[model samples]
Target: MSEQRTHSPQEPQRRPRITHNRKKTRRSKAAAALLYVLFVVGLSAVLATVGWIWANDLLALNKDYTSVIVKVENDESFGEVVNDLKKNGLIEYKFLFHLYGWFSNADDKIAPGTYELNTDMDYRALVTNMSASSSTRQTIDITIPEGYTIDQTFALLEEQGVTTVEKLQDMSANWNYKFTWLKDLPLGDYHRLEGYLFPDTYTFYLGEDAKYVINKMLVNFESKMGDYMDQFTEESQYSLHDIITIASLIEKETDGEDYGTIASVIYNRLENTGAETQGYLQIDATLVYLNGGKVPTEEDKAIDSPYNTYLYKGLPAGPISNPGMKAITAALKPENTNYYYYVLNPETNKHEFTRTYAQHQALVEKYGTANEEG
Candidate 1:
């Protein structure tokens, strides 16, 4: 048995041969890896194609169309907006547009308005232009001139159909605004907001309440008066109301360049301690206001009105007109002078200032008329 085993071993030990199943298993693994790589590449290409189409749709997809007005209702939904764009031919891809809106968080931010849209607008432009609050409402441009009285301003607004006269009068009388300067104002007629409405150009929208416009003017007055607010402390001789009243007088009395000098004359007349000229402002403009814009006669000057400076000493009951910034500034910072009288020189359209009554009489004789008195 040993000799036979040795003879077989000499035939040698044949190594283990590779089976067909094993070779097939290795080839299968390589093929599976290659197929997986090919599948991944194909999926990536498909995704890239879809991304490019979506981006193109969001950008300049509709660049050659005419503009169209599209109205979005107040409680409209994003889906409804997308449908509206599709219906108006403003957008082509509804799904992609909605997706873009969702991604940009613009779906919830779209304002309800009548939007001016065009097929030439991209998704971004359409979203931006349609989101404005003003686009939904109608607006009017109103220009209120300087030195216009409240009555005058009301007339102008009524003429433009901005509001009714009754509404404006009602608001003016009873608004009870909380301005600090309006706190201690002397009780007067419904024109309590006389000088408080700062005169300037304004833009008012249609359908706005009367109080809205009034508050807008008051806010503008407060903003413009910010520069002079610090000067109106308790130590100052005049309140803000007093300064505005004086400024209104100065505005009606003289031109731009002579505001400071006219303010000085007003201050001199008020601050004078002399027995002859003490506490008498003698402003003819106040008499004009009392006479309802008419030239005041001697009888009109003697009328019993607090606004009559010829009768009542010191400033008038309130402002005579809404003065502009130039007059307001001059009233805040008056020229330091002893001049107490001024008369308009017809030859030069300027005021002639004088210190004493005698010098004032000289200017009156030189420049005054029977109807015009300083």
Candidate 2:
């Protein structure tokens, strides 16, 4: 300003204007850069928030442990399964679960059954639990006692909700079980598998197919009798069916205390068919079986039935009851003795073996009781 000596007016005004324009340009550029940074930061925060929510759902993070029972139909679609999960409060995001299922190919791996799922399970675990061999599938522990008849067993199965008795009966009669011993026994009779179903505690799936349930018992029976199968088939004069029949008789006769002695008496009676015993067996349990689980009266022995060992000679048509391993073994290997008669002693609650009719009559008179079984 002090040096304003003869300067041109157009030149001074041009310099000031150029400086002002440069300052304005620098301020505008700084503001633009700040606005761009704020925009980038805001977009990044929004994207991060969305990513966190998605990852949390996919991973099942921060979820309370809650159990839910899910039943998947055989023909249920993946969409239906996702809907069930949502309805059961197992999943938060149905679409996200569908996306995960699509990526993991879970549609092809799901199986038809009832499953027990929890909320803490991740997407991968959920898919795995829906598989055929899932451990989380619902199951029932059924203990079929020894001596359960086919009807009784089926009733128990139905009672436990494992299957219907009608279905079990139908399958038992029609299913052609692949086993050598089963060949001689024809179909069309549900009692064909009466003595073969093993009696043990079994874990069955809820609403299990009747065929599968029957197969499990049959397979268990085969495995349990595997060691004795060869012996019963080859060396023994009796067929495998015959052994089971005799064992069933023994099982129904006594309370497992006199199994071996009863077996000896039975063998003796069979051997001396022409002797005083006349091979009648005279087992009261047989009459009881034919009399509809009633205590056999004196007239009940005269009933005409193949299962009536008192009337029919030799073994019955089939097993009278499902015998345990002890009774079965006793039948396979009977004790060698000359006993042809036996009577239950009321005082001792055990059968007294006799070689002659006179001794048996004496015990019967002394005990003042008819025979329990022999």
> Best candidate, TM-score-wise?
2
Per-residue lDDT of 199 in model 2: 83
Model 1 stretches astray by more than 4 angstroms:
1-136, 186-189
Clashing pairs in 2: none
Superposed by TM-score, candidate 2 places the C-alpha of residue 205 at a distance from the truth, in angstroms, of 2.6
> Candidate 2 overall Cα lDDT vs. reference?
0.83
In the range 68-125, model 1's lDDT, one tens digit per residue, is: 7676654578899899988987777898887888889978667665566777778887
How would you encode candidate 2's per-residue C-alpha lDDT over 1-374 as one tens digit per residue?
A: 57766955675444345878889999999999999999999989988988888777778887888999997765579999999998988888999998888888999988766799998888898889988799987889999987777778899988987777888888889999888889989999888998888888999876677888899998998888878887755666898998888888888775558788778888888778897889878888778778778888989978988988878898888987778887888888888888888877776777778888888888878877654346
Residue 267 of model 1 has an lDDT of 88
Clashing pairs in 1: none
lDDT of 1 at 254: 80
Q: 320 in model 1: Cα distance from truth in Å?
A: 0.9
**TM-scores for every candidate against the unseen true structure:** 0.63, 0.69
**At residue 340, what lDDT does model 2 achieve?**
85
